[model samples]
Structure formats: structure tokens, C-alpha cells
Target: MNQPKKMALIAANLAFFIIVGFFVYQRFGIYLNNPWTRDGQVRAQVIQVTPRVSGTVIEIAVVDNQHVKAGDLLFTIDASTYEVSVQQAIANLERERVSSKGAKIEYERLKDIAAKDAGAVSDKDMIRREVNYQQSLSRITVAEQNLIAAKLQLEYTHVYASVDGYVSNINFQIGSQAIANQPILALVDEHSFWVFGYFQESQLNKIGMGNAAVVTLMGYPDTPIEGRVESMGWGIAPADGTVGYNLLPSIKPVFQWIRLAQRMPVRIELEAIPDNINLRFGMSASVLILSEEDSP
Candidate 1:
């Protein structure tokens, strides 16, 4: 072959390979970005167990990591103070009731006397008796409310599980002072298990709500959990617009040359979880969306 002919053939082959490679790269990129992401995590609603009434924890019923049903006793606070308050409230209510009864009798007596002999009960005196009776009624109402509140407080001493869940680490122990409204433990909601997938915004067109998805946990790669897209997050914190200590929006400089697509979180509600598998919050997960034809 002539040298010029050989050089032309070499250039043709190189051009053909380049063309093929370019198309392959584009196809590969599409495949890589469309349907799956490793940036996912098993998440659930965590209930922060805060005490409603403050007192020393006299008894701890369940240990950390123990699974409990709704209404299960968690721990008991010292009910001595709450009990005393309840007794005092009861006593106050009883006293108020007796006083109210006596006032009503006195008012009725005055009313009867005024009806029989118009001059017997003066208008001012009748008014005073009626006012006293009404005041007694008001006091009784107040006492009744106080009694209810005290009973509620006494009941609050025995904290119970608000949801069926596995208890997280309990920071407080027996004899620990649990302050009112202070979170001492956390409960990982068992039934609220869901997976959150962070997908690139550009890839969202391929995903939709109610779309079937498969989640493979990092710990249990062999078992895939089935789920459906529940919802998409409405917003995220802007990376460039971070707040400073001065309470001002501190905009950061961005690299103008390359703009990466931001990832949006999609919530996936897991179907019935297998008994063998225990889903916990913040577990690493990989999510893949199934095509309509591929879904069962």
C-alpha cells in the first residue's frame, strides 16, 4: 500500500472510534444518572420522650433499646408531690362544695323571707347574700378545675409510650431528676419507617409520586425492601446562603464555571417490613426506581 493511503486509513479508523466513544459516553451518562442513587437513608419520626411533670425518677420500667407498644409504661416519676397536690386539691374542692351548699341555703332562706315579708330582707342584704352564693359557686368551679389539673399532673408521673417503637438510649436512671418538658430519652417510631433518597434535580423528571422503588440497606444488601414514593421535599437550605453569627445572610462565592445540579429528597414509604429485618433511623440505604413495565 502507498504511505499516503495508509495514513488516510489510520485517520478514518481514529475518527470512527472517537465518534463511537462520544455516543457511548452520552448513553452511559444517561444510564448512570436516571434511576438510582446511593445517597439514601432509612429514616423515621423520632419521638423525644420528655417528662411533663418534674420529679425524681423512682422506677425505670423499660431499659434502652426495648421495644414498647403505645401506652406501655416507660418510667415512673416520684408521685409523692403530685399525690399531695391531688389530695390538697380534693380537700379544697370538698371544702368549697360544703361552703357552696351552705351559701345556697342562706340565699334561699333570704329569698323566702323577702318573698313572704317584703320588708324583712333588705335589698342590699339580699344582693350581698346572692353575691356570696355566686362567689362560692365560682370558688367551687375553680377548685374543680384545680382538682382535675392535679389529677392530670399525678398521672403524668407515670410516663407511657406515646407510640409503638424501640426506645433509644435512656439518659436518665432511677433517682435521676427529670425536669418537666425536658427530653430524657428518644423513641424511634417503628411503624413510621421510611427511606429518603436524594436525587439530582435533573433526574426528577424520571421519578414521580407513587412510583415503585426498591431500597437495599447497606447492612442487608441481599434483601430489597419495596416502597412507593410518598412525596418530594418542597425545599432545601441554599448552600450559598448560610447564616452568620450576626444573623445576616452570608452569601458565599460560587465557582461560575461549573454548576452542579442540586439533589432533592424524595420520601419513600416502605411497605410491610419483614419480621426478620429491623429498620432503624439513619441506616444507609440505596434506592432504585423501577420502571412501570418492570414493576410487579
Candidate 2:
């Protein structure tokens, strides 16, 4: 309405526009200088918890999603059978030891007689006694090995956590039959957390090993995680010519005029995480890899 007020209003509008323009320019520059992708996921080492010895699960020391430390007991299989096996092995070993001692004594006695009087003990008899002693010694070794194996199997019945991690996907319960070498649950290694960013081929040139990276998880947008580029995938499975029905090559139809750039996984190793933040497997993330010159 007034001249002075009009000038003040115009000045205020110009200042606001300039500030907005500067902010936009700065963000655009950051994007142009860095490679970013929304196709990112949180990853970690998932260890399959498998039992070396099969038996009924008599006790479960941990529940699903429980945090565990290395050497912590996970579950207990019915160790009664293994205990019996160990006892049997010990008895067999004792028997072998006794037989070996007797054989050795017999062989030594024959050897002493033969040395004193060659005609009293035949050469064939001495040879037979020596062979029997040697065979008995061999049997003792075999029994020792069997005992060791039995003890190992018995130890295996008490499953322990192999690493510091979180137990996951525990589908079995007490009294559940566990088969040898079959995974009963999964353990997500807490210290092995990393990010896998699927970046377009065109952006590969901007990414390099040890490059600084920023990851914004979908679940925790306010807290950004710092990381570095560890490695890049060398290849991806081709979707074009895979074996399909009728034993023929199945080729995907693509537009002749448009070609989609293939995405390759770039692994990012996360830095020290904040105590407040929790990293989980398969969480969606947004990744930004900074240029070498811009990295701190």
C-alpha cells in the first residue's frame, strides 16, 4: 500500500528466493558429484546353526531373536545315546589295551626264549607272536580313535553359539528331531553388518574401493550411517537367455529403442554404529557414495 512497505516486501521476497536457489544448487551439486541409489539393503553374515550330531532336542537354552555371545549354549540334544556310545568306546579301548599288553608280554617271552635257545622257539613261532603283538597294538590305536570320535559326538550334543550374534528363525522346539548337518536356525553376526547397494552400470565409474558412503535406512531416516565402499560385484545373472519350459532358451523381450542399465551390487562396510541404532538384515536403505576428493 505504501512505498516504503512495498520496497521492504520486495526485498524480503528476493532474499527468500535467493536462499532457496542456493540451497537447491548445493543439493544438485552434491548429487551430481556423487553416485546414489535407493536400491540398497542392509546385509550381514547369516550363519546357519546346524547340528553335527542328530538327536531329539531335549532342551532349548535360547529363544528366537535372542542375543547370544560366543560359546553360549544354544540347545541340548538328548545326550543319553551319545553317553552310552562313549561308555562303549571306553570299554572297547580298555579291552584293546588289555589284549595288547598280554600280546606284548607273550611276544617278549618268546623273544627271550628264542634269543637264549634258537631251537627251543621256532623262527615261525617268533614271527607269529611278533605279528600278533603288532596287530594288537594297531587295534589299540583304532580303539583310541574311536573313543575320540565318541567323545566328540557327545560334545556336539550340547550345541553352542559359534559367534556373537542374534539367534533368528528358530522353528524347532523341545522334543523336535534334529538331523545331522541340517540347519535348525539362523544367526545374524552382529559385527559383520554391511550394506549392499545395487547401483546402475552408469554410476559404477563414480564408485571406488574405500570411497566414503552415507546410508539412510528406511526405518531410521533421521540417523545416517557412515560407511566405505569395500567392493563391487563383477557380474550379475543375465535375465535374457535362461533355460525355460520345453528345454528352450527363454529370452526376455526388450524394447529396441530403450536399453535399461544393469545394476551391480556395491558392498559398503559400515563404520562404528551408534548405540541407539540397531542394524538388522534386509532393511531397505538409500546409499550415497562420495567422490574421493570429497571423502574425509
lDDT of 2 by residue, 89-177 (tens): 99999999999999999999998898898899988998999999999999999999999999999999999999999999999999999
RMSD of each: 8.3, 2.6
lDDT of each: 0.91, 0.95
Q: At residue 181, give the lDDT of candidate 2.
A: 98
Candidate 2: what lDDT?
A: 0.95
Candidate 1: worst-modelled 10 consecutive residues by lDDT: 26-35
- Candidate 2 residue 103 Cα shift, in angstroms, is 0.7
Query: Model 2, residue 77: displacement in angstroms?
Result: 0.6
After superposition, the stretches of candidate 1 with alpha carbons farther than 4 Å from their true spots are: 1-34, 244-253
Model 2 misplaced regions, further than 4 Å: 1-24
Residue-level lDDT tens digits of model 1 in 40-82? 9988999999999999999999988999999999999999999
Candidate maximizing TM-score: 2
Deviation from native of the Cα of residue 294 in model 2, angstroms: 1.6
